[model samples]
Target: MTESTTPGTASGIREFRMPDVGEGLTEAEILKWYVQPGDTVADGQVVCEVETAKAAVELPIPFDGTVHELRFPEGTTVDVGTVIITVATGAGGAPAESAAVREAAGSAGAVAAGDQAAPSAPAASDEEIEPEGRQPVLVGYGVSASSTKRRPRKPQAAPSVPGQPGAAEGGPRRPEAAAIQAEFNGHAAVVEGPTGVAGAAPAAVRPGGRPAGSAAPSVPGGRPLAKPPVRKLAKDLGIDLATVTPTGPDGIITREDVHAAASAVSVVPAPEAAALAEPVPAAAGPAREIRIPIKGVRKATAQAMVASAFTAPHVTEFITVDVTRTMKLVQELKQDPDMAGLRINPLLLVAKALLLAIRRNPEVNAAWDEANQEIVRKEYVNLGIAAATPRGLIVPNIKDAQAKTLPELASALGELVSTAREGKTSPAAMQGGTVTITNVGVFGVDTGTPILNPGESAILAFGAVKLQPWVHKGKVKPRQVTTLALSFDHRLVDGELGSKVLADIAAVLEQPKRLMTWS
Candidate 1:
């Protein structure tokens, strides 16, 4: 992904939008920020690191100037093409003007003290105090003043008869739950007093009722404070904002607060009903479970696996092979002068054996084109080796493996494994593979019916090699043995073709001399 440059505005501000970091990815999470407001930056300077569905990548700024603002906070997943940061590109304004521009933009989204309506200012008129300044022209948020609408209050209950409770006090009729509508978000809620329990009575009464005091949270026209997104969320969940207590700064309701309120509404009873309900003990220690947000490679991998599993009909075949000779050959290759400085391991030979099988059975290396109703046979072999990393499982292939020499193939395989292990495998490296190999043997696993990588025709799972008693030449003998499971898209490779490919790999392993005659 590259920086998107916007034409300079009159404020000398240039908005830098998030680019499409992967193949048409819609969004990326800002993992960390390297610069803050007022920090000087240069062209091509790395400003932040972001994790898309594919991988984590560093984003560099294309403009050289003071970083006027960072639009989103760290860990925020922003949509592609949204302005992530803005810079003072220096055009039609003085340095002071630029500084003020930055300040206005920064403060516009900030929470302020006295964010609620002033006590002297009546709330019944749907009016709000605006910050005094030339409003910063943010893209999504409007500059118009914000206001809240108070729900109309219901009438108080008629005074009780002479013998009733209301009559005993010789006072006016007491207000019902709806009477608190004016002081909150118009919901007939069990109003809580300053002590944070339900009040003895409703706070805001209509005409001919108790006068509201400092204890009354909001006046007749005021509504609960929340951002537009939070308001939308509350509306979607059918929750009244006033009934939801705000925990954010300056009495603003946040998404978490709204969600918590929704959950409470569903599970917990109202205070009046719960008064007669049995009490339960509160939790006494740290939470029992932890939550990890899935993003980047893991998310993409999960989606791909699901799609592959359901879309492609897979057939797996297993074979047990005696690889005592192949093990010796691996040691011999490590000592070969031509293989010096190259990584030598059983995986290297296994990869070569699979490449040979694909050459012998080319139809197994083909893809089913459902849309075109045809089979696409590939000529070149992009042999994929599945490597597990801290981020996730990524299979980066050695391109054109069928043409590579023994030492060259060893070098490519080594580089691929090391790069994936270090979490440096690029998106391009993981794309367009025709076949794959998963070395489950590294973990001492016997075998697994491996799932095909999305878009790839087949995958091979190599199991643990260990000394086991076997009938060698009709006599009991100890030999190196391993199991191999090959899973292929049945739509492309039939039973005969799939079996032949798997058998060729086993044959190459069993007869080490085939390396001289096969090619």
Candidate 2:
């Protein structure tokens, strides 16, 4: 296990390295493996599913071959550029040496489990294969040579017992002999002494009256059982897991347990102590205390939000407008023959209006590049629609959204929503976004100052559309109205530019015919 060996043959072996499934993600966990040894696989066939920090992605093999070996087991987190599986292209079964190599690879993976400090083996030079006439490459991924090396195992020492001095270090004793001595002599077992009287061996009784020296029982480690996020919470609160009493299933330390421990040590004011002692009935439930591991989509979203909030100077502007005409247009589109079987909703027109606004005020559709100290203006728009899924919030955008017609945009939006709801959104679809629109209207919220998505300059929040009293043409009447809030990075977009973009969107929604003239 000390040496990194390639798990393939010399002639016709291909090692499929773990690709970076997200934007510069360094590692991913192998959730499941679809193919095993001796299975025939074709090009573009999905071989495995991996969960990165963003989303769960399925990796497709690029070439046709028989599965030779899977280097790492499922649930093992593998670094990008490391080989996870190998395929054999030869006509026959794998060579005898390849089988031995597969066994060695499995042993190495087991020895390195749960130990991130373990060194990995270097990529095998002989196992690297180049297809004839073309260099192989994965889209949005680059090939790099890397490996994991294993640390040598250390020998286990005998457990030293208290109050015993040089008792049983002589040699190994037979269990049967010890049992016979206990039965016939009606006394505890004793080991032979060194030129002296027989001495009783230090025998610690285990459960069920078995001697500890007969069979060593496995003892759990001192580290408490808790998820990564729970451990992080405990660290942040300066709470020690070993000191807290665990009430969770399997003796696992939960977030609530950590919080309770923190509250116990905190100094409370005399006035609030009586109020805090009263238990709130609303918090009572079997599932009220839930601990979710902050990983995958949720973890990435949190990190991005923090970076965007602190790094950019955010300016939020709100405007309330009458959108009665836009709702009429939605109903008209749903009745149109060409728009049949397509999703037609208020959000669709809102998105189109935002795109048109960007066209009018192109300066707002830009990102501030701090590294280059320049404003990067985008000519075409990659309109990002923020969708909340069961896993977390993900913003998947349509590529070249400015060029799409209304019907095309509607179709793309429908597909995007469906894919996100199913939790099958690819990482590429979530990248290269220039602007975003978050529809808080669906949740019946009036409006909100939404934080900008990372790498984007502006974000528009579409609020709930409600019929309210308004003055129209100097007459008081009930009209369909909605509130819109636009948040932008002040560094690249000033107050004037941001206001123009917001005003343009409000005008188009108020007067539906303006979309034709404005475009």
Task: List model 1 lDDT by residue over 1-519, tens digit each.
Answer: 444444425657676888998878998888889987778889999999987776678889987888866766565677888877877777443222332233332332432212223234443445334456544443333223335433322212233367776454443433433344322542223333433333445344323333333112233344444555456557756676656654443234566776776665532336644222123222355434333556778888899999999999999999999999999999999899988899999998899899898888888888888889999999998999988888788788889999998888999998998888876677778788999999999998999999999888999999999999999999999999999999999999889999999999999999978877987
Error of 1 at 208 (Å): 22
lDDT for predicted candidate 2 compared with the true structure: 0.70
- What is the alpha-carbon lDDT of model 1 when measured against the actual structure? 0.70
**Candidate 2, which ten residues in sequence have the lowest lDDT sum?**
150-159
Model 2: runs farther than 4 Å from truth? Answer: 1-14, 63-76, 88-289
Q: What's the distance in Å from true for residue 452, model 2?
A: 1.0
**How would you encode candidate 2's per-residue C-alpha lDDT over 1-519 as one tens digit per residue?**
011224444547677888888868988877888987888999899999988877788999888878876766565567888777777777764622222233333223332331222124223222322223222222223233334332221111222345555424533333345434332322223333343233333342222333333122111223444445456667756665655554443234556677777665533346754343222233222332334346677888999999999999999999999999999999999999999999999999999999999999889888888898998999989999999998789999999999999999999999999999987899989999999999999999999999999889999999999999999999999999999999999999999999999999999999989999988
